[model samples]
Target chain A: MNSVAFVIIAIFTLAAALAAATLPNLMHAALCLVLALLGLASFFFLLGAEFVGLVLVFIYVGAVAVLIVFTILLTGRDSREHRGFNWSGVVIALAVFGCLTWAILKAQSLTIVPPHIRALTVRQIGQVLMAGYVWPLQCVGVLLTAALIGALVLVLEEKR
Target chain B: MTPTLQAFLIVSAGLFSIGLLAALSRRHAIFILIGIEMMLAAANLNFIAFWHFAPPPHPSTGVMIAIFSIAISAAEAAVGLAMVIAVYRHYRTTNVDQFNQLKG
Candidate 1:
């Protein structure tokens, strides 16, 4: 059952990612991004990262993808022009893929006996985050604040 | 056959490659941002796959890292789109080839 689900979700994710990468329409690409992100969230769940998966759904699909769409709408430009095929880009992508595949295949496998993990819950995650990971959490909070301020400063129209 | 960690890693590699293609080939700033997002998602997927397969002592570490990565990308996407808006307003175009001021 889980394997079937994984196959379905993986296919959805890859297809959506392909569309997001290749679609000529920016709006269509943004919509595809949402689908890809949602599919990723499902992958997280399949891997037993439940809390993180839910957060991915909320923050990525709900917030970031929506933000991309809003930016497109607010810019009010026709961003549909295809830049044609980039031969150099295709070559680079293939090169990178080859390198990565070779490296992944050459590397020694580290498949340890799966350690016994106590069932993880949202409460456990929150506790651990606030306890052990508080410093990094605070730093991310600062980064988020900075981003919000920077965005506002950039987009806010000056009254002439 | 049940999906193995190698299967997940292969998918991630494919996604990353596709994303690189998007980021490199797309002339539009927004598409580049989308590509970057895809790459980031691929990285997160890799992290989760390793965490699940290895089952670390601190089991949540992978998830924790994934969370932080996602948070950072969210911030990145906001700032990046804001920059794209500013660039569009200034140059009246988003095509990478047309922008000539940066070539020194």
Candidate 2:
């Protein structure tokens, strides 16, 4: 049952990601990206990373996808040039895929026998985030604040 | 067969490759940003999968890092799209080919 769910989620994720990448319409691609992000969240959940999964949905699908859509609409240019297929990109992507697949296959023999899975509670994660990881967490806070202000400054219309 | 770590890696790799292609091929700046987001997501997926499978004694490390990446990517998207909006306002086009202003 778990494997079945995993397979289903993986298929959805990969297909949506492919669509998000290949679709010419920026709007459609953004929609596909939402689907892909949702599928990835489910994949994380299946892997038992519950917090990360929820964050993926909330952050990626909720915020990032919305931002992309707004940008597409604001820019008023959603269509790609009608230059047919971009063969160079296809070739490069295929080559990269081939190399990565070969690497994965070769590296399979060097796997460390995984220790029994350890279940981590959100409480532990929170504790560590506040205690051991406080500095980086603060840095992220500052980064987000700066990003918010910068975005506002960039998009604000200038007074004549 | 059950999904293994290798399976996850393969999926992540595929996602990353697709993202690379999109980033390289797409003319729209927003689409390029989307592709970059995909690549970031792929890397996060790899991190979470490894953490889950062979986590160190401190299991939260992986999740924390993934959380950080998610935060950073969110910031990235916000700022990136804002730049896109500004660029569109000035240039009236989002096509990468048209932004060859610095090309000597």
Candidate maximizing DockQ: 2
Which pairs clash (backbone N, Cα, C closer than 3 Å) in model 2?
none
Task: Calculate model 1's interface RMSD in Å.
Answer: 1.9
| Chain A TM-score for each of the predictions | 0.89, 0.88
Scanning candidate 2 chain A in windows of ten residues, the lowest lDDT window is A77-86
Q: Which regions of candidate 1 deviate over 4 angstroms?
A: A110-117, A158-160, B55-58, B102-104
| Clashing residue pair totals per candidate (backbone < 3 A) | 0, 0
Q: For model 2, how does the per-residue alpha-carbon lDDT over A63-125 read when each residue is reduced to its tens digit?
A: 888778777777775455435456798899999999999999899552654456677788888
Model 1, A84-145: lDDT tens digits are 86779889988998898878766678434445445678888899899999999999999999
Minimum summed lDDT over a 10-residue window in model 1 chain A is located at: A110-119
True contacts kept of each: 0.64, 0.74
Q: How high is the TM-score of chain A in model 1?
A: 0.89
Q: For candidate 2 chain B, which ten residues in a row score worst on lDDT? A: B52-61
